[model samples]
Target: MEEREITIVKGKRSTPFSRGILAQTLSQAGAKPELAHRIASEVRAELLAEQRYTVEEEEVLARVRDKLIKKDALVVERLDKWRILRESTEPIVVLIGGATGVGTSTLAADVARRLNIQSVIGTDSIREVLRHAISPDLVPALHKSSYAIKPEDIRIPVKEENTTLYGFRIQASQVAVGVEAIVDRGLKEGTNLVIEGVHLVPEIILDRYRDHPNVCSLVVYLSDEAAHRSRFYIRALGTAMRRPAEEYIAHFGEIRQIHDYIVESARRMGVHTVENFSIENSSDAAVEIVANRVSGIAEKAARRPSSLLLDASARGG
Candidate 1:
């Protein structure tokens, strides 16, 4: 008996070829057409359970047909007799940032979920980590440099478990090291980082990494005047999880001013901007924008020199 050789090609945002292969294999084993289809569906569902598809479900069936066409070409030409194969890997990085209440965190998470990539990292988490490793007094100073905290005699409760405790001690010189660590660990692991915060501007952090090939930095400013003000007021009134109303109310103006400055800085940096006023549709729109941008960056990187990887490797060195 001659063995039939098979080749598999996976498409971006498409169904698994293993399903069709299962159906064909079962049919070759003398199974009925209906039984083969049923068995293939079960097998495909099991295989697909381990992976997530960013593409729509309907597109998967079409993708399967495309894959089958390519397979047919290979079989017709008997190309298996001579092997010529190449594979390229390209990763994408999306740096999403904005003011405190601009829904940056939620947007990052939503984008990550849609892309099926875990690369989202909030800037607040970075700040919190830095604070944890530095002196509490230095936090106010660092915050001042980023213009995120206003000069005031008011004292803030420094949580020991928070990242900003020691972050105040982190110098601008040290920011590169922190960013490198995050990117190497996050992006290399196939997670798209959505680092958000007032300080995530190019002048502050990304300038050090602008030329890196693996990184496609995007600064998203979520603009919503009415909603922003309403959210700020809600925080000022003190939510169930936070401090008293008077405490937040006293600093409302200062916080709002800081956010405005951040938005202005982002605008000056020529960051890709998105006006996210409609909160209801913002998540889906954000996901689409981010995914499309990332896909573009990845496609470009595929054609670029491998030396680009060296740019990422040189970070913090």
Candidate 2:
């Protein structure tokens, strides 16, 4: 008893025993094997009472089947089933970019909600997070670089929920890094990602992963002249007026130029273009269009490579 770790079996006091010793005694007792198994199960349950284990039984089974197929442990039919299951489970990645005040953020939120994705990342949030890595003095300049309003003139609303504006400016490099982090995380977790911003596009964010099988990046340009002008005017009169008129005017042109550049670049890159302005009812129509296009893209991506390979093999044959 002194040399070995011992525990007193307190249940029913059938016999005084240690933990391991009790298990042996229970097995050897004149109890039916099934009864003894039940007793052992009960004892184990009691011992683990304070700990909690969440077992998703279906997910576990699927994973086990997948592993078997990967390892060639299953029959041909079962292996085919596992392969189909694995292909169907791969996730989708969507990047939505448009000019400012084009409802990109709002549309992204709606799409994410429709998809039941609770984790949503905006470009502004990513910018704020990367602010710490930027130089303090250079941050103000960086902020001004992308905007018509001077850093000093812009007074962000002082509210608990509006703290996303207080951080340092995010440079292009920083924005690219943040986008990659979010996109990579989403793909790895088998979850969908909606990245909305003016800067999200190829040669910046999506180009890095152009070859990835699970990634789908679409450039949505809101191209209604009247709506664009109206929104621009409203924004200009609201928070943008804090800056000098000349500075504000200068930024307006710059933003417009950037928007045109993005549209042209998207076309050149062959990214799917959705004309949000043409839709009769913008919000609802935008959501419907996004859902349809995204689903279609996902389906195409899942099948395109296989089809291409099959065609190539047929040609070779």
Measured against the true structure, the TM-scores of the candidates, in listed sequence, are 0.53, 0.50
The best candidate in terms of TM-score = 1
Residue pairs that clash (backbone atoms under 3 angstroms), model 2: none
Regions of model 2 farther than 4 Å from truth:
1-88, 137-141, 149-170, 233-250, 278-317
**Scored by CA lDDT, what does every candidate get?**
0.46, 0.49
lDDT of 2 by residue, 1-317 (tens): 23322122222222222233322222222222354344444544543452323322233234333433443342223323322322344565657776655656666675554343455667767777766677546555345444443434234444532222222123444577878888888888877566778657555675676566656566566565556656656656666445444453445555565566567767877665566663223333434434444444354444322211112112210
Worst ten in a row by lDDT for model 2: 308-317
C-alpha RMSD between model 1 and the true structure: 13.3
lDDT of 1 by residue, 119-175 (tens): 566655665677678665654554333322332311545543322312322333244
After TM-score superposition, the amount by which residue 205's alpha carbon in candidate 1 deviates from its true location, in angstroms, is 1.9
Which candidate tops lDDT? 2
- Tell me the lDDT of candidate 1: 0.46
